[model samples]
Target chain A: MTSYTDKIREISKRLLKEGKVDMVIGFTRGSVPMMHQPMFAKNQGDVDRFVWDGNCGINLANYVTDRKEKIGIVAKGCDARNLAVHIVENKINRDQLYIIGVPCTGMLDRHKLTASVAGEIESIMEDEAGKTVTISGNGFSETYDRAAVLQENCSLCMHRNPVIYDELIADKVPEQSENDVDRFAAVRKVEEMTPDEKWAYFDDLLSDCIRCYACRNACPLCYCPTCFVDESKPQWVGKSIDPTDIRIFHFLRAYHCAGRCTDCGACVRSCPMGINVRAMTKKLEKDCLENFGWEAGLTTEQRPPLDTYKPDDPEQFIK
Target chain B: MKNLLEHMGIDPGRLHFSWISSAESTKFVEVAKKVTEEAVALKSKEKKYMKTKPKVA
Candidate 1:
């Protein structure tokens, strides 16, 4: 398989040399092994620092919002969708972007790998074409099929190719067939419980939250100048990590991205406490798709489901 | 949720509520299919309108 790293370098260099963009946002080798950090390259010399691999999973779209300089961004499927959401939400202008779209198969779930392996993980490597991962620790090493380690959101993704792009770096990746995939199976399981049971379930799920706000900062959809949590005029949620406050914080966070979330999994990936925040967002996504036949970031022209309404809408739930 | 969305001028279609016990698998499928059809129809109508009266950007 062709190296995505090489292609990203070529495209970024060309864009910078041609003055097509003021800066290119992509990934660079992280200080730690088995990870990558988002970086910006403003000149041709800096493009060489750009890298792409299974570890380059952080959504680059988060860095593009409110950027005055023209930007060229390397976007995976979810990142592209989030950009589309940004365009529709007026967070960023589409005219200011030169999107380098990547047809992502999936991203590696680092937390899963960390939990399954023994000892401190010293080094890790992945061969995307071979669909395998090799990890070496303090005393042992092993290789496993890459599919077994895919991020949960990626495993269940319906749109694996960019729904919008300025230029695709490679041929579009085929979407996973929905025939047997139960993307909402977990959500449905939680829904089957009684109100008290459901409450306790989420309470336990978010119990480890430290109120760090990494999830919010990582999300491209979250760009409000004053987040509701930080509002002083009418503090919507407590700043402390009280369980009830945490619960409301999560609920509001998920609600804010109701129709706009692409299920990018960025929030879960960035959470220091390893909370499965997708549990909340996915429920809203299922509801939006089921009720309004809407998926966020598919088109720039169409307003989000919640932004527009028809006179005769499904009101079975409303009294 | 429906009440809040309604007050906000968002389509009530944006929210759906139904009760399906684990034993009522058939009822679940039936409700799902009906809701899917309704949403599809609403989207089609919106698309048709947008095509006829394209919004100026």
Candidate 2:
């Protein structure tokens, strides 16, 4: 990962020096352990601050929306897919970007790592071989296999290499084959439950929601000028933390991203209450894939299934 | 919309979608009857998403 960081800095510096892009977006070490913050490098001097590691879970595609200046963004597989989405949506132009693709090796889940130990994490170090992560706190220190603590989305990722890139930092890594991972196993578990059981399951899942909207803010797809939740004429969702309100908020938000979500795990990563917000979105993703033979952000040339009319489109639900 | 609602444990019959032109009264009536029958069948199930009166102040 250090070599990845070095290569990123080298490329970003050259881009900045040559005046190819007005800004370069990448990740920098966060103030705390296992939280990487997005950094915008506008000049050659700022290039040295960029770093890459397992902690860069936040999607860089969120930062490039509607930007007027040319951008050189550091994109992993999911981020690059999102960039493709942005291009298709006309939020940004393809000519305005210089995508620095980083073939991902999955991001570490901080919650999983924290749950493994009893104390607060003071520092974390990833081995040069990129196979192990060591964390130390007050009195305890432990090393964990990188694969064991990977975020759920990362483990199930089918596209680990960027779909689009101007230049890649390293040779593409192997992708997770469909046979190796049952991507819809969680969705299937929920599907088997009775209606009452399913309701109770989601009720328990969203019991801790604080209505902070961290998930909304973190998502790259949520760029609406006046989100439905904020509408006054006929407010689609209540602002209070009522269980019904929370459920509606989550449901509608998931609906909005029906055919466009890349399952980048930004919503899951940003939740302060540690909600598995992917539960709602992943169901839609599975539906899109199964019903329409569509996966979001795979290409910019074609519109999503939901956005276009097709003669063979599934209409089973419409009686 | 119906798929997601059903996925969240809502009764699939509660929502219905049909393409009926204004002149097609027979088709509209036929679809409406089916929808109402399905909704009535599940009437005994407790409503899942309806906002109720505050149980406690």
Candidate 3:
């Protein structure tokens, strides 16, 4: 893992010095414990600030959307997948990119970590092996296996290596085996409930939403200049954080990401309220995979499932 | 959603409708083949008309 970080810096320096890219977008050590911030490097001096650890969870692909600069980006499995999505959507050109692919093990779930810890985390140190994280604060410290604290999406991730890349920092890690857990069990549970029960479930699930739009801002696929929430000509959705408005916002956000979302978990991670926004997107992902046999960002040539439909697509819900 | 995209000038072939249950393997194959054929046809249609469509000044 340390070697990978060194390789990233070395490559980033070369890309910048040789004028291969105008900028390199990667993670820097965050001011807080267990948090890493996205930083841009324009020169070799700036490349020294790059960091890669369990906390580099935020999707760096979000920074590449619609940017004209010849850029170098550090991408984990999900981030790389989203980058592929950006190329296919024409938000960014493939030629403009120098992807530094990182085969990710998984990202640590901050929410779960906080829940597991009783006090504030003074500092967190991840093992060089990327297997365990030691968190210390408030006169106590504990080390836990990295897997126990993995983000929900990462735990269920099937693609842990970059689907597309200009260069890989390390050997590609093996993808999580399907026998780990039933990824869609929660969605299946929701499906088993009655209509009213399902409605009640979502209502309770999303009741805490403040409508800050952090999730939208963090998503790589949500590059629409005018999001449905901002449309005033028809006023598709209300601006206020009304329950109905929140539901509408989540619905539209999920719908917009229907076939393109790689389940990178950026939206879930960015949400201040710790809402599982994937609840909506996961169902859509399942539908896409099961019905259309489509997984986002696998190839640049293949069109998204929704964007190119078959004459006989699943229409069980349609009259 | 399909209706809205079509209303915005997206090709109708981009939207498809079919039904297949988990138990129905034959139906899934049949539907999959039909969809692929339609998609191919639609692509050629788009290419043929792309040159003929009048350009907006």
Q: Which candidate comes out best when scored by lDDT?
A: 2
Per-model TM-score versus the true fold: 0.84, 0.96, 0.83
Best by TM-score: 2
For each candidate, C-alpha RMSD in Å?
12.8, 1.7, 12.0
Q: Per-residue lDDT tens digits of candidate 2, residues A21-46? A: 99999999899988999999999999
The residue ranges of model 2 lying beyond 4 angstroms of the native Cα positions read B52-57
Chain A alone, TM-score for each of the models? 0.97, 0.99, 0.97
- Greater-TM-score candidate between 2 and 3: 2
Model 3, A118-236: lDDT tens per residue?
A: 99998888888888988889988989998889999999999999988999999989887769778888888876665446656776888889999999998988888888888899988
**Can you write out model 1's per-residue Cα lDDT over A1-319, one digit (the tens) per residue?**
2478889899999999899999999999888766789999989999888887777777888998888989999999999999998888887899999999999988888888888877877888877574899888888898889888888999999988988888888888879877848899888887667544665677689879999999999999888999998898996876766665676788788889888999999998888777998988898888888888898889999999888888866876632
Q: In each prediction, how many residue pairs overlap at the backbone (N, C-alpha, C within less than 3 A)?
A: 0, 0, 3
How would you order the candidates by TM-score, starting with the best? 2, 1, 3
Which candidate ranks first by DockQ, i.e. highest?
2
Write down the lDDT that model 3 would get: 0.83
Give a tens-digit lDDT track for model 3, residues B1-57.
Answer: 543223223356646776678999998888788778878886744542232323333
Against the hidden true structure, what lDDT does model 1 obtain? 0.82
> What interface root-mean-square deviation (Å) does model 3 yield?
15.0
Q: Sort the predicted structures by lDDT, highest score first.
A: 2, 3, 1
TM-score of 3: 0.83
Name the lDDT value of residue A228 in candidate 2. 88
**DockQ each:** 0.04, 0.64, 0.03
